[model samples]
Each structure stands twice: as structure tokens, then as C-alpha cells.
Target: MQPYRPSPSPARRTVLRGSLAASAAVSLGARPAPAQARSGRPRAAWGVQTGDVTSSSGLVWVRSDRPARMVVETSATESFRRPRRWEGPLLGPDTDCTGTTALRGLPPGTQIHYRVTLADPDDPRRTGEPVYGTFRTAPARRRDGVRFLWSGDIAGQGWGINPDIGGFRAYEEMRRLDPDFFLCSGDTVYADGPLLPSVTLPDGRVWRNLMTEEKAKVAETLDEYRGVFRYNLLDHNVRAFNAQVPSIVQWDDHEVRNNWYPGQILDDPRYGEKDVDVLAARAGRAFGEYFPVRAPSAGRIHRVVRHGPLLDVFVLDMRTYRNANSPGRQADDTTGILGTEQLAWLKRELARSRAVWKVLAADMPLGLVVPDGAVDFEAVAQGDPGVPLGRELQIAELLRFIKHRRITGTLWLTADVHYTSAQHYLPERAAFQDFAPFWEFVSGPLAAGGFPANALDGTFGPERVFVRAPQRANVSPMESPQYFGEVDIDGDSGELTVRLRAEGGTVLFSQVLRPGRVGQ
Candidate 1:
């Protein structure tokens, strides 16, 4: 079959055209397979997932092999003899046969067992196999404790699904820890990464990737972008992990392409088209369709997830609102990393939050310098050592606002550097002393190529307390180390502990912090 070619015209860049909508409508009324004696088997292609858990509500997601109606039966008991059934949206070709159901009015701080059933659209009696998953609702008040894991950069740099050893082993280890939820910081899929069938390792061993057509090249069309997401589900470990643990997901540059910004023209010769906005639109739509997340206002993915009085996670959308990567830095520069509106929203949320610990779940680090190319950079810091410039100015202002507002017990967690490390930022060492001292933990490459740490931008005065990574770049998972970080907030003492663990679940570094003691 010939690859689908999308028109690169500016007029057609706003929306995805062609057979997408028509096929979606036709799929809605499509007939299901004929019922057989054993038709009750579950057919969840991507397994079951529950996310965005609140005091009274949560989101459940599943995908079917064909057009079907998603039905979720929930109960407090594992047996689920008298479970309550909730109907989900239609699973059709429009959303690539994926659907998410909002499970609302759930009891706070209670474990809810759910079984997902995908019934044939034509014959409701003929259902696929049922998949079981579980999630705990957020507490209504301060409770015993809260534990969650966080990481990013999955299936990137030729590190694709390996059928021999399940998928990403880190996920298996994380599931063993059994945290309340998983914060997928960013780089959920490398839309621009190409995966080959096989490659020769440095030790003469053959490393194989479970290949698919969409992952063969850079994602361009809607199908190719959807394929990128589907490729990750090929890993049984990932599917199993998603089923058990709820995921709070966000996106960085790799979902569309590395170091991409809105309105930027593609200069890479590998892509036949030049406009990046069209590709981003397709990628964003696919991301929304696949993940079990609430639609954000104005299409921005940045939002807050409050877990009672113990914790409040602020998931930042660093990719959506940003300025073009350039060399210039001025105090009065209107262009920034968080943009104007997002920056303001963050401040308002921080001030209004009543949780004991305000965790800034950021996609990118505040101080690390991620250079896009020879003259451009991707994150807040632009490699300028001393003074705040350009994007750094925005970060400086936000940090200053946190200090001015007297927001205590705030921490930043990120995972784009592909390694694990604990960094301490002190006001005494910083050029700008208006901000309070805080710790930022970084870990990941959950199943991607591992690389050495990037240089720190001295604007924030980050001191590396601990660093664990290979000296070389793009090392395979078998040869290199992978890491994930976990946060434990104690209900009784109100103490927060951060742990950075390796692939085998070994705690490489740990730190304990208490409220009101920051910067002391």
C-alpha cells in the first residue's frame, strides 16, 4: 500500500481532512463479528487504564480491536458481584477505536475495582474478553500517606518494543513498588523516531525491535501519529503497568519532533513537508484521543491534579506555550518558555492551592541547558551562565513569585535528561536570591537511549547532589542504566521523601524534607 500523503498547503494545515471523519461516522454504525460460543473473551487492544483521580471522580480508558461499545463495571469488592455499570463513549475508527469513560461520584480514598467489557456494536451479546484494573480515589482530607512514581522519554532513539523480555522492564519494577499513580512527565512517544527491525549491538549481540509501519519513519499523517501511540502498547509490560497504575500524562517536543515550536518551519530534509503546525495538530489530536485525560480549556494541557491536603501536582505543558528557539535574551522580551497566560495561571494556582506539598511536575528542568542546535536552545536556560535572559527571565519571575507569596514545601520533578540525579538549588549560590532554596529530582528514558547529563545553567545555581548516567550518549537499555523517581508524602508528619531508583528497584539516592524548613 502506498503511504498516505498529506497536503502541505497552509489552508489545509488547520484541520485533518480526507476520510478521517467519514470513516469515523461509518465505523460508528458498523456491524460486529458474528457471535460464537466463546465470544465473551475480552479484546482490549491496549489494556485498561484509570487516570486523573479526584475525590469523587476518575477517568477510565480502553481500546478495542474493532468497533465496539465500551462498558465499565465497577465495585468496591474484587468479586464485583453487584457492580455498578457505566457506559463509555463509542470506540470507533474516529479515535482509532479508543474510548475513555468518566467514573464519577466515587467514594473518596477508596479502592475501586473495575472490569472493562468491549461489546460488539452490532451485537451487544457478543463481547470480548474482560480486562480488570483498579484505582484509589483521592482522599477527602489528609490521610495516612501518598506515594507516586514519575518518569519520561519512552520508546525513543531506536529503543522499540522487545518481545523477548516483555517491554520496558522499568515499568515492571515500578509496578512492583505499587505507587498510587504514575506521572509520565513527557516524551510519551517519539513521533519522529524511526525503529528498524534489528540492529547489531556493540557486543556482537542482535537487538530486535517489534516493528510497525507508523514507527518506520517520522509521523506525518493522523494514522502515522496514531501508530506511534499504538506502537507502545505492543509491550505487554507497558500495557500491564497502565492497567494497574493511573497515569497523569503530558507532552514535550518528541511527540511531534525534537525541539519543535508552534509556527516553526521544518528544516529537516527527512520530512517532505515544511510546515510543523500541521504535524503538531495531528499529533495533539491523536494524543487527546489515546490518553484518558480531561480536555483542557483552550486546548492547553497544563493543569492541576489535587490529592486532598497531602499533595497537589501541577502538570506543566512546556511544549504548547513557548517562544521560538533563538540566541537573543532581553529582560523586556515578551517571548518566553511558559508564555504569558500559562505563567499567570501557574501563579494563580500556586497561590490558591491548599495542599501541604505543592509538587511542580514539569516536563523540562529549570536549570539544565538543552540546546536545540548551534545557536538555539529548547528550555528555560539558554546556557548563559550569570544573568537571567530571555526564557530564564520568566523562570526567575515565577520563582520570585513563589518566594514572595511564601509558598512553602514546593519541589520540582522532571525527566528529560535520560538519567537519574538529585539537584539542590540554593539562594545563596544563585545570582537571583529572591527565590527560596529547593530540590529538583530528574530521572528517566524509561525505555529509550541513555545519555550523559547535560551542562547546568548557573542562573539558578543548581548543585548536583548526585548523578548516575553513562558517560557516552545513546547507549542501549541492556548496556546502560535506566531510572525512575518516587515521592512519598507522610500524612502524620507532613514530611516529603524523594527517592531515585534504578531499573532493578534499587534506591540510589533518597532525601527527606519537611514543610516550612525549605532554604534552611
Candidate 2:
């Protein structure tokens, strides 16, 4: 799917308005059927979700128990008796047999009830039962008091002795928070649902395929990426969560192939990866179909949305433009987390924003490093499993930019590296490393894995100045893998309180971030 951009023609608005006027409560658009009618249950599919809802439109997504055309409708309220809506019949092949229809003419800052049904393209009488859900449009430019959830790295199904660790339990707990939206930092799915796949080559010989690009990008292949998303979305808690609220999503490596960088897919060595563009194209297609994301732009995951006076969120594409992790014992200063184009766009957005809080919704950590002032270029070069390389330099530039523009009310929220912690960077400090104090809160993995106790103890970076001297500011509390992070803002006071919660609504950690705390 092509990236979403408003049409510029004078008749563009007329076309949109006309398309939105097809029906009172529900309307169907022109859609051609797939080559064959689908019959049989989707390998792993369930859940009715809404994504990328602007003041006037939103995307409705679902997969049927059986391959059939699907219809989605939206209404102004729960009792859809009289409401504006949009609907479309979908063919179940190109988009993983899943359907994503766009709903238009929705009012801003309002909640609407929606339903999805498996329909028969030729005979409308034979259709599956409709599934009901809810969604909210983005608030108007003058609105305020918005809230959302941010977390990452959910545990997936078990393999051998390795148990499943997913956000199923965490999501259940987050339901109580009633966030308007949620952001996944990455690793949202475990490709190894039944367990990591052990591939037997074309020659009956066995090989391990992480399902990275090489193994699955061929015209026909379903590896970890597909399997993981299948299983993750199947979780009742996840489906229920999505059905209840709209989500704005972007992916990390797990969504495609694990530990993938800009041009490389971390697949097994035996299989040759498909061309980068082809593989990336497939991954993008699958992700757009499964998640409620706005269509992607050039296989890149970066976009910005303003939620009235409450906030301005910039979702980044860290994996698409990164330099190859760091090669051996060297730092690739030229490598950037945000490609030059994205970086330029980010600067302009940052300078032009008018919201009270501007959040950089990063998929990886932006400001944390090894405590001993050491850089593990080897692990980085090899594309270490959990380390965030190039983040330091990214933060350096980000902090400098913030300082230069004198932007206020800024914060960084990220996932990946499946743990919870918060650190601040201040570049004006007396200590060389503490010269920058910008706060970052890292949250992830609804299910914790073998992450060691206090793993970040001595790993605090110099950017942080502990509220308590001598004690580094980078240390995080020991918490369950089943945790979610939240940002609750008190608009009148201009105070933002971040809370880290465990399953069952347990508040494990909390911090209050204020204005003028950075670059002081």
C-alpha cells in the first residue's frame, strides 16, 4: 500500500465527501474478489481492530474464521441506527486473507461503534455473524487532555523449555487504564509461537531459520514473522484490547524478522534472502493488513499526528534507515537512527509543533549505554540481540536539536530490550557525560525473559545525573516482564507523570517529568 497523503486537487475534497455519503449507517465501496473464494478457517485469526483514525476517517481491520469477503461499518454511537459510515467488501488473498477497510466522515474527538462481518461476494445471504467493536477519532486541534499507552517486546508462545512471554496478561491489565491509543515499541510478536522454527533445507538437512528476510520473503513462505503475529493477535486480551480502543502502531524487528537492520534480514545462513525491496515490500504488506496502521510510506515507518493541545506524537522508523549496527571495534558515527531525510523532517516537525507535549515514539532506546564508559562494538557489529547501538549519537543530535530550538515539554518513550527503566540527559552539567539531561523511559515485553536482575546497574550512561549523587541515574527497578508504560498529563499544571504498571494493575514505578528539566 502506498503511504497516505491528502489529495491536492480542488475536486479532491468533493470526491472524499461524495465517497463518504454512500449510506446512512454503512456504505460499501467498489472491491474486486480474489481469484478463488476462501473456504476454511484462517490459520490464526481473530480480533476486530480500528487503526489510524483521523478526524474524518479511520481504518477497520479483521480476519474471518473462514476465507470470505468482509464488510466493515461504523456509526456515530453504539446504537448505529442513524450515523455516517463507510464499508467495503474485501478479497482474502493479497492482505493475508485479512480485510482492512477505511471508514470516512467520522467526527473528531468522538467514539463510534463498529462491526465486521464475513460476507459472501456472490450471495450476501450466506455470511458469518458480525463482530462488534469501538473506535475514537483524533481530537480536534483545539482539544486537550489526551492519553495513550506505550510498551514493547511482549513474550511469545513457548518452545521446548522456553515458555511464552507475550503482552496477553499485561494487556488485560492495561484495559483498566482506558488509554485512547497505544504504541508498540517492537517485538510485538514471537515468530516462534509453537517455538522458534528449525528449518530442514531443500535437502532434508536441518537448519535454524529465524525467519529473517532470507527464509520467508520468497513468493510463498510463512516463517516466524507471520506465525508470531498470528499467535500474538489471537490472544483474547490483545483482541479485546484492540476492539475497545483504536491503536497507532509501528514495528520493530520481530514484526518482520528478528534483529533486522536497514538492508539485512536476520534469516538463517543456508537460505538466500530475497531482494531487500521485495522482502521489505512483503513485510510491509503483511503488517498493514494485520495492524490498524495508516498505509506505510516507502517501506518506512515514520509519521506524525497531532492530538489537539494534548500532544504531538512522532512515530519513527528506526530500523529502515540505520547503519549496519557497528562493525567490529569501530563506531559508525556516520550511521544514523533516522535516515537523513527523516531527520530533516523530524527537525522541521519539532520546530513547528504547537502542542503542550511532544513525544518521540521511538522503537528503541534513545539515551542509555554501558555504565563503564565502554562500547561493545563487537556485539553491535554482530547485531547483538538486545543492545541499542547508534542510540548515543542519535540522542546527542536530538538533545542538541532540542537545545538549539529551545523546544519545551519534550519526552522520549521507547521499547525494545524488554525491560523497564527511566533516565534523563542534561548536557549543561559540570560532569562531562552529564552535560545533557533528557529523560527517557523504556518499557517492554508483557512477559519477561532471562533478563538478569538489575541488568542496567552499572550500565547507566553519563547523560543522567541521579537525583541522589554518586548513584547513577540510569538504574531501573526490578519489575515483571508483564508491564506497560503510561503518560498521564495534568494540562493545567503542565506536569506529565509517567507510570510503569505490571499485570493486574500493579504500579511498579512512577515518575513526574516537568518542563525546563532538560538543557538546564
The 10-residue segment with the lowest total lDDT in model 1? 11-20
Q: After superposing candidate 1, which stretches have Cα over 4 Å from the reference? A: 1-42, 296-298, 518-520
lDDT of 1 by residue, 1-520 (tens): 1111223222111111221221222222122343342244336746777788877888998878677899999988766889999999888878788889998889988877787888887788888667777777888767567889999999999988876656688887776676778999999999999998888888997778888878889999988898898777766667667766788888898999988998999889989767889898889888887788888314668989988788899999888778888873767755588889999999999999888899898999988888888988888888887878888888888999998898888999999989988889988887777888999999998999999988887888899999999888899888886788889887888888888888875788889998765452
TM-score of each: 0.91, 0.74
lDDT of 2 by residue, 462-519 (tens): 2433211113221211223355788876656667788766555556667776654444
Q: Model 2, stretches more than 4 Å misplaced?
A: 1-45, 65-69, 141-144, 156-167, 192-224, 265-281, 327-332, 370-391, 429-436, 448-450, 453-481, 515-520
Error of 1 at 196 (Å): 1.2
| lDDT of all predictions | 0.81, 0.56
